[model samples]
Target: MVDALLDIAGLRAGYESTTVLRDIDLRVEEGQLSVVIGPNGHGKTTLLRAISGLVTSSAGRITFAGQDITRMRPEAISARGLVHIPQGDALFPDMTVLENLTLGAFLRRGGRAERSQQLAVVYDIFPRLAERSSQRARTLSGGERRMLALGRGLMADARMLMIDEPSLGLAPVLVDEVYRQIARIAESGMTILLVEENFSRVRDLADRLTLIENGEVRASGTVQEVLADPAVAATYLGIES
Candidate 1:
């Protein structure tokens, strides 16, 4: 049986006095790529925030690595190897690429050599980052900045990476390139839970697809299963059965 690395049951959260997510149920299995696709403003980002402890859940339970972490502090959650890379490239504008990357390892416990080795691994996955290691993060192009954000997440030595809208605010070409690197990371055995607005981009990469609408799970299964559902096809895919 495949073990669920992250599980959410009936999770509800939102800004103060307003609920955005209601009865959200989802699970990401170990060593698999799970994709959550939905329209904008449908609580996709909010769900990720609740999982990462940036937004607290008002009800339900969140279990990570077999422990209940419904109310864990954000830093405490990060220490458990669950890393969240938000939608935009949240890098340090004045910091160099290398500086931003190293900061992701703050939760990691090790000496210089160990950190260096991990840095090498990330560099191998994203050569462009290595090439621009000395350049200020703000100077890099959109795609390069996304790569840096991902590289920083990997630097955390994350057991599972939660990325929100990686393709957001990028040119078509850059979106493809970013997804290619994401596939490379998944190929290297990184468990990823990715949020995307476009289903076509992730249809081939996702092991499982969960559809969220109005802050609740609308459909979830293997990619084929969800795509084949008549209601989902008609409403989300614009296909009539």
Candidate 2:
């Protein structure tokens, strides 16, 4: 039987008096790269925040690896191997690269040897991180900061990853590099739920896509399926044909 890596049903979340996410039902199976795309302020980031437990869900169930974690705290959800890398290079500016990565393994009850193993794996994936291991995070370029953010998430041996806007401030070349890295991560068999505004890139990289609009899911299907619908393109994605 194929086990679902992350399942969200009828999920709803938002800030104080602001209804952000409404009845969102999404699923990401194991070993697949699913992307979520839509126009600005369509609850894409909120969905990721909800899944990571940063934003509280007012309604519905969220199951990761078949366990109910709808109301779990952020730390608890993270410890369960569901890591989220938010849009803004959320790195501690003054912290050293190694210090930031070390924090990722803080929940693990493992010693130096285990941490060392994980760091090696992360460095293998992002050599820039290894090169600047002792430098402060703020000293790195924008793309490098993003890479470190993702590398830190991998240090958890995450079963599934939810990343928001991997291409936000990157140059064209850097965008392609980021996409390549994301594809590489998925190629290694990890499930990824990526929320991106870069539709052209998502269209090419996403195996499946779910479009959100006005805090609800307006369309969900394969990339081609969602992109082919004129209504979905115009209303949800704000893409003019």
Candidate 3:
């Protein structure tokens, strides 16, 4: 956990009366890609939610950039450089792609020049977004929607990004494209925390990983170590534990 930008210790949270994340400990080192991979019903999405403050935490501490944010509001956490892109395309279906991306910086204290600078960077990351700047978000293809979502996160100037399922519904090629863009984003020096079901993609991109099943972390390690354990892989992947 050295150089850790986002740290969670003894984290426990869930919907009312239904515990989801239990004693979860995680770390995302600066400029690293940390992925959480598990099969359906393993609370991957819940973990992301818990980190973003969308779900209330019943216990534990969350520190981001050396500050505690265990009970902060979503907007508060976001402004402090933690951006969460939840599962599914949560775009403003009625708005243009450019409009959606612009909104990501609404909370930022930057002036016009800063806003322009960030927009240019976003276009560099996803030229497709630049091309469809005038197009409504709803009209975009699934892959394009994912791009916009990430682009929006970039505009937020997040120090650490929590992205849930970058390849949820795209074709194989598009999925690869999405994951590639994600990697590119990580390369830009911001830490990334991802929740993904595509085990292949996760293995290819993550610097480290944590396995969560039935609301608890089952394993945590480098890709080779975790994937080699039949019990660990099966417990989270739901094959044969």
Best by lDDT: 1
The number of the candidate with the highest TM-score is 1
Record all residue pairs in model 2 with backbone atoms less than 3 Å apart, i.e. clashing.
none
Error of 1 at 204 (Å): 0.1
Ranking by lDDT: 1, 3, 2
Superposed on all Cα atoms, model 1 deviates from the true structure by an RMSD in Å of 1.1
Q: What is the C-alpha RMSD of each candidate to the true structure, in Å?
A: 1.1, 1.9, 1.9
Residues 73-129 of candidate 1: C-alpha lDDT, one tens digit per residue: 999999999999998999999999999999999889888888999999999989999
Record all residue pairs in model 1 with backbone atoms less than 3 Å apart, i.e. clashing: none
Model 3 / residue 44 / CA error / Å: 0.9
- Give the range of the ten consecutive residues with the poorest summed lDDT in model 3: 232-241
Q: For each candidate in the order shown, give its overall lDDT on alpha carbons.
A: 0.94, 0.87, 0.88
Per-model TM-score on C-alpha atoms: 0.97, 0.93, 0.94
lDDT of 2 by residue, 182-234 (tens): 88888888889999876788777788899887888888999778868998777
- Residue 60, candidate 1: how far off, in angstroms? 0.4
The residue pairs in collision within model 3 are none
